[model samples]
Target: MGNIQKITPNFWFDNQAEEAAQFYTSIFDDSEIVKVSRYLNEGQEIHGQSEGAVMTVDFKLNGQKFVALNGGPQFKFNEAISFIVHCATQEEVDYYWDKLSEGGDESAQQCGWLKDKFGVSWQIIPDILPELLSSSDRDKSEKVMKEMLQMKKIDINLLKEVDQA
Candidate 1:
């Protein structure tokens, strides 16, 4: 049996927590919605409006916990921090790249870095990155790095080819 655990990430949305959660869960495997609680009647009122509404939501993405809060339009997702998906083949890279890039912008970088439509950054990298970095040939490693810097989704075969050259 699976052990009891907690996986949580706090996400601020402009009244789109549910929508975003559903969208995210749809894109990933081994993910599902855990619970959603809307506002209820609390004896207190602020500005003639209910003080609490959708205080919190718990969802899971690939066994990771994420908490979505209906915090007003105070902050938004940026590229400062991003989720990295390590892939072993071009097929894996293509799958994630196509899925996440939907309704999002794409920026190419060395290794891997791309900004999705929601302004959230993602790095779709290959499993061979470490191998290339630790190669004995500094020139080949440098070349691989230079080539990677120009790509959004890392291509493992391409990196290997660069390393060989």
Candidate 2:
């Protein structure tokens, strides 16, 4: 097979690497476990234990490759970086928003920004966002964006109304 493209997001869990992977994959469609590689006898050890348990897990979500690690809790997911998913329709937006926000906090913002239980942030934006933002009318676009910034989970209809005004 050709070189498979992957967007690996390393997670440092205390000991919940596998559980986190299963929980995440189960929440998305077309997602499944790809591979699980535990620590080998020759690998480095942590806390006097050799061969780190659940060293890495390769998984896919909606066809996107992601790798999870059971590294120690030296770091955690923050709001600095987030995944932005462009939805073609309101239905798609709702589906992702609801699913992703199940055990996470929903933030208020134009477009879409939500934080899952894992504290990993995501932006579920509409495909039409670019179109609206790039419109010739800067004032209208700004208005639409401002309106979006104040709400949680983008509403395409509201944005369209703002665009028309």
Candidate 3:
């Protein structure tokens, strides 16, 4: 915990940096808001945001460093980059899926992936997914993949059942 992170993931949000940081910190354990900065006459004309408005929020999610920037809407979050939450249990998956997907675009959810209210994409995947998918049995892995593709929230129990089928 004392060592500094080498590379931090930065998220660009359209005026929701503080809110998003708070939301994420509240959901994750050992998380906290470290600092916050405001825009003060820097790139004002291009950014088009008011002075003194929140420009950045530095936070930690489960002890991992992350930055949330209040950048303008020049860029939008897409499937190009997403954070995958590797859950060890079905309960963890359910909790994260339910919490992150609240007030988010439900229709965008597919294969344990969903876009949060702030438009950030997240994958609430179970830890057993990769193990089962990489199994030597092609038929079972294929069935697991097939079932995964058809569901919004992943059903680990169903995947396990199909893996043994």
Between candidates 1 and 2, the one scoring higher on TM-score is 2
Which residue runs of candidate 2 sit more than 4 Å off their true CA positions?
Answer: 40-52, 107-111
Residues 37-153, model 3: lDDT tens digits:
999887888878898999999999998999999888888899889999999999999999999999999999999999999989999999999998998988888999999999999
Quality of model 1 by C-alpha lDDT: 0.76
TM-score top scorer:
3
C-alpha lDDT of residue 124 in model 1: 83
Cα displacement (angstroms), candidate 2, residue 38, comes to 1.9
* Model 1 Cα lDDT, one tens digit per residue, 19-102: 778888888889888899776676335323255556567888888888887766779888777888888788888888888778
- Using lDDT, rank the candidates from best to worst: 3, 2, 1
Tens digits of lDDT, candidate 2, 54-116 = 777888888888888776677888778888887899999998888878878654233488887
TM-score of each model, paired residue for residue: 0.84, 0.85, 0.94
For model 3, the superposed segments whose C-alpha errors exceed 4 Å read: none
Question: Residue 154 CA error for candidate 2 (Å)?
Answer: 0.6
Model 1: how far is 64 from its true place, Å? 1.5
Return the TM-score for candidate 3, rounded to 2 decimals: 0.94
